[model samples]
Target: MISAYACGPGDEPEAAAGWAFALAASTFCDVVVVTRRRFEGAISSALAARPELAQSLRVIYLDRHPALVALKRGQAGIYWYYVLWQRSLRRLVSRLHEQLPFDVVHHVTFANDWLPCGLVGATSAPLVWGPVGGASASPVRLARWLGVRGSITELVREAITRPLRRLWGDRAAREASVVVAQNHDVARRFAPVTAHAVVEANASILSDDLAAGAASSAAPNLVGPRRAVFVGRLISWKGARIAIAAMADLQDWTFDIYGEGYDRGYLERQVRRLGITDRVRFRGHRPRTEVLAALAEADALVFPSMHDQAGWVAAEASALGCPVVCLPFGGPPVLADVNAHVVSLERDLPAALARTVAALPRGRGERSHRWDAGRLPRFLEQTYDRACATSAVAEERPGRRRVPRPARAQRR
Candidate 1:
C-alpha cells in the first residue's frame, strides 16, 4: 500500500482513513506500508503497543526534502510538494519492487482524484487506485453562505485547478487496473476513463469500537433543548456557518463545534453578530476519543459540508446511533442510515436543520448498522483479484498491449 499521508496516532480524516485501512489490510495478509517520514513516530508508537502488528507490518518511511517541507505552508505549496513527493516515490517503489516483486500496489491517500498516483503503470505489478475523490463542487446557490472572501477563494481555486485535475486525473484513471471512487460524484468523473470503477466509501468505523460505544451508552434523552454537535474543520466549504446560522432561530438548542481552521475568527464573529454566543461554542480541535465521546452524547450532528467527498465524523456519529442532519449531497448521504435526516437544497439549510432537530425523537439507543471495517479488506482483496486477472489477460493478448506512458505525463 502506497499511502503518502497515512496517519495512525493522528486524528485528521485522511490519516484516520489510511490508518484504518492499513490495520484492516494487515489482518488479512502481510502488508508493506509506504508513508511520509513525518508519520514515522505515530506509526511506530502504534505498532509498539501491538506486537502482532509489528511482526506483520513492514513500514518504509520516505522523508520529504527540507526545502520542500519549508515550501509547503499553503494549499498550492502542499499540492506542489505532493507532486514532487510522487516523483521521488516512483523511484523508491521501483527499487523496492525489484526485490519484492509485489503482486499488486494500492495507492491509498491523499485521496484527491486531481492528484496522480505515481505507482500507476510505473511497475509491472497491477495497480489499484482510490477510493479517490475531489469531484464534489459547492453549489452556486450556497455561495452567499461562505461570505465574499470565502466565495472568491473557492472560485479562484476551482478556476485554477479544475483544468489541471481533468488533464492529470484522466490519465491516472486510465492507467489503473481498478479505480475505487469514494462517492458517486467521483465515479461519474472517472466513468470516461475506465469500466472497472466502483463506489466504496472511504470512511468506516471499527466494529469493536461501535460495540463499545453502544455498550457504554444508554438511550439519549430526546427531550427539551437538544444538544447538536458539529465535528470537522471550521473551513468555508465545511459549512459550519450554516449550523451557526440555524442556532439563531432554535434558541432552545445549543451547538458545539469541535474543530479549528482558518475560518475560526469568521465563525466566532458570526456567532457574536447573531447574539447566539451562549448557544454556540467553538471547541477547537479535540482528540479522536474526545470527539467520539462528544458525538455519543450529542443529540445530532449538524454537518452541511458543501464539497466534502466524505465526512468521516458523520459516519462515526451514525454508528453511535446519533442522528445526523446533513446535506443530501456528498458521502454523508451514502453512509447515513434511515435514522439520519437528509436536508435537501430546496429548503433553507438553517430552517431544515431546525426542523430536523425539533422532530428528532429522544431516548434512541445505539444504531445496529454493520460497520464497514470488516468489508474493506474483502473489497480490496476482490479488487486485487480482478486487477490480476485483467493484467493476465492483457499480457496474453497479442497486439493489444498499450505502450506505458511516462509517470509524469500519464493520465486517462
Candidate 2:
C-alpha cells in the first residue's frame, strides 16, 4: 500500500483529487491522505466525489497545529524549528505506519522534515520523497528575515539548525529509494542527494469549453463592469493591499477580495484609508465551487504574493480561461506559454497595472487542457514500478547522473 502525508488543510480540491485519482487508477496501492483537523470537511467531500478513489483512498485527520507543535517540541525559533521538525518528520510516519500497511510514504511538503528521520538510515521498505522547493530566496536568507533578532541570534540559530538539517535531511533523502519532484527546478536542488529523482508536472484542467470561453471574451459583463478579482487571504506576503493600491485609478474596474484570515480587518482599513471603498469589495471566503465559477466570469486574477511554493491560482485561472497578472515569479514557469502576465515587484506596480490593462482587450486562450484522469495515474504506476526494480544502492556519476528508466508515457 502507498500512503500520502500532507501538511495543513489543502483547499485546492481539484488538485488533491487529481493526485488521488491518479494513484488509485494506476496502482495496486491504497492512498491515505492525511491533513489537519480544520480541512477535513473540504478535503473529504472532494475525495468522495471520485468514484475510483472513494473506496481505495482514505483521509486521515491529525490534531497537529503548527504553532502548538512548535511549542510542544521546545523549538527556540519558529522558522528554524520548522526546519528541524522537517528534518525529524519520521515521528509522523511512525504514527501513520500504525494505521495502514504501506510500503512507501509520500510527505507532501518540505515543512514536514520529521519524515526523513523515520526512514533515513533504516534498510526496510522503500520511501519515495519529494520536498517543495524553488522559493523566492535561499533558505539561509529567508531564516535571517523571519525574526527581528540581531545578527548574533541569527548566527546562533543557523549554527545549530543548519548542520542538523544537513546531517538528518541528507540522510533521509539520500537514503530514499525514489524521490518525485514537481519540476526541474525542484529536482536540481535535490539532485546531489537522491540518485532516482524524477520530475512530475502538476496536472491542471484545460478543455474545449474553456478555450471557447476565452474566444468569446466572456467575463461576466456586469452592468457597471465587474471588478478585478483577488482570491487569496489578506496577508502582507499575499500582496492584496498592493493590488488595491495599484487599482486606485481604474475606476472602471472594481476589485472583489475573497477568503478569510486574521489580516481581513487590517486590509479593509487599508482599502478605506486609500479612499477606494466603492471600487474595492471583499466577498470573504466563498466555497470552492463558487470561487471557480466567479473566476470564470472575472476579468483578471491579481496576486503579488511574496513567496509561494507554486502559485495555485495561476493554474486555476488557466483552467477557466481567465488571464492572471502577478509578480513574475509568483506563478510557475509552464504558464509562460499561456495566460499569465509576469510583473516585476521591485518597480512601480502601477506601471505593471497599465500594461495589464492594455492587454485585457485581447483574451488569451486557455493554456491547460482538460486533464485526462488516467494521465497522472498511469505515470505514477510506471514510476513506482521502475523505482522498485532499480532497488540497487544509488551511486553518483561524476558528470550527469544516469537517468532512471523512463516510465511508460501517456498520450495526452
Candidate 3:
C-alpha cells in the first residue's frame, strides 16, 4: 500500500483527501494526514465532510506545547515558528518518522516549489511531491500582452528571479524520485529538466455523490437576482475586491464574498465605504462541503484570483455546471476550454464584469457535477500503479537501488 502525508489546509487537504478516498476504495493504499496541533481540527473537519470515506482515513494530530499553538495562531511570529523553531519540527518529524510508515511521502503543498528537497531526505521512503510553487502562465502572458511596458528595473528583477526560481525547483525537485504537476502548464516548466516530472491534474471530484440529492429538472435558479459568488481569502491581490468594485455600477447584481483572511475587517470596511455594503455580503468562512453546495446554487463563480496558480474553486464550480467569471491567473490550460466567461484585471475590470454579466446566457444546460468520487479513485490508482511500476523497473536497472514500497500506518 502507498502512504501519503497531507500538511496544512487549502488545496493540499482537498487533493490528499480525494486521493486517499480513491486509494482506499479502489486501490490498496492508505493515507495518514499529519498537521500541527492547531490544524488538527481542520483535519477532522475535512474528514467529516465525507462520511463514506472517513473510515478509510487515519488522522494524526501532533499536540506540541500550548506555546506552539499560540504562536501558530498569531500572524506575527508564524514565519519564525515555521522555520526558526527547528527543534520543535525536528522532534515532531522524528516522532512521526518513528510512529507512521510511509513508503512514499507525498507533501501536497500550495506551491510544491517552496520546500527544500532535503526536507524529506532523512526518511528512507521515496518522496513524490508537487504542483509546486504558485505560478500561472496566463497572467504573466496576459501582463505582457497588455503592453504595460515594464521599466528596466522590473525587467532586471524578472531576470534575477527567473534564475532563482529554477534553482529553487532544482534543489527541491532533485531529491524526489517522482514529482507530480497537476496542470500541463506546470508540467511543461519541469519537463525540460526533471525526467521524473509527471503531469497529473486533480482527480478528486469524480467521487462526489451528487446524484443522490436529485433536484428538479428546471435549472437551479438562485432566488437572488444575477448574483456573483467569489469564494477565497479576502486578500489584496486575490482580486475579489476588484470583483466588488466591478459590480459597483451593476445595481441589479449582488456579490457574496465567502472565506476569510487578514483583510476581512478591511474588506468589510471597504464595502461600507464604497456604499456597496448592501450589494456585497461578507459570508466569512463556511465548511468546504457547504461552500461547494453554495457555488452550485449561484449564477456564476466570480474568481479574480491574481496570485494563485490554478483556482480549484473555478474548476469545482465549472464541474458543477456553474459558469466561471475569471481573471486569468495561469496554469490549468484546461480552463480556457472549460465553460468560463473570461475577464482580465489588466483591462478595465468594471467594464469587463459589466459586459460579462450583460452577455451571460440565462442558465447553464448540462454541465458535469463538480466532483464525483468513483472516477477519481480509479485515476489515482492508475497513477500509483504507474509510479510503483516505474520504481520496480528502476530497481531492475543496473547500479540502481530500488525504492521500497510504502508500509501502511496503523490506524489510530
Best lDDT among the predictions, by candidate number: 1
Task: Look at candidate 1 and give me any clashing residue pairs.
Answer: 170-411, 170-412, 171-411, 171-412, 222-362
Tens digits of per-residue lDDT, candidate 1, 22-75, equal 887776666778888888788888888898897557888875778868878976
Alpha-carbon error at 378 in model 1, in Å? 1.5
Cα error of candidate 1 at position 143, Å: 0.7
> TM-score for each prediction?
0.88, 0.65, 0.67
Go through the candidates in order and give each one's C-alpha lDDT.
0.77, 0.55, 0.56
TM-score of 2: 0.65
Q: Of 2 and 3, which scores higher on lDDT?
A: 3
TM-score of 3: 0.67
* Between candidates 1 and 2, the lDDT winner: 1
lDDT tens digits by residue: candidate 2, 306-347: 444355666677667677776644234433237677665445
Which has the better TM-score: candidate 2, or candidate 3? 3
Q: Model 1, residue 338: displacement in angstroms? A: 4.0
Best candidate per TM-score, number? 1
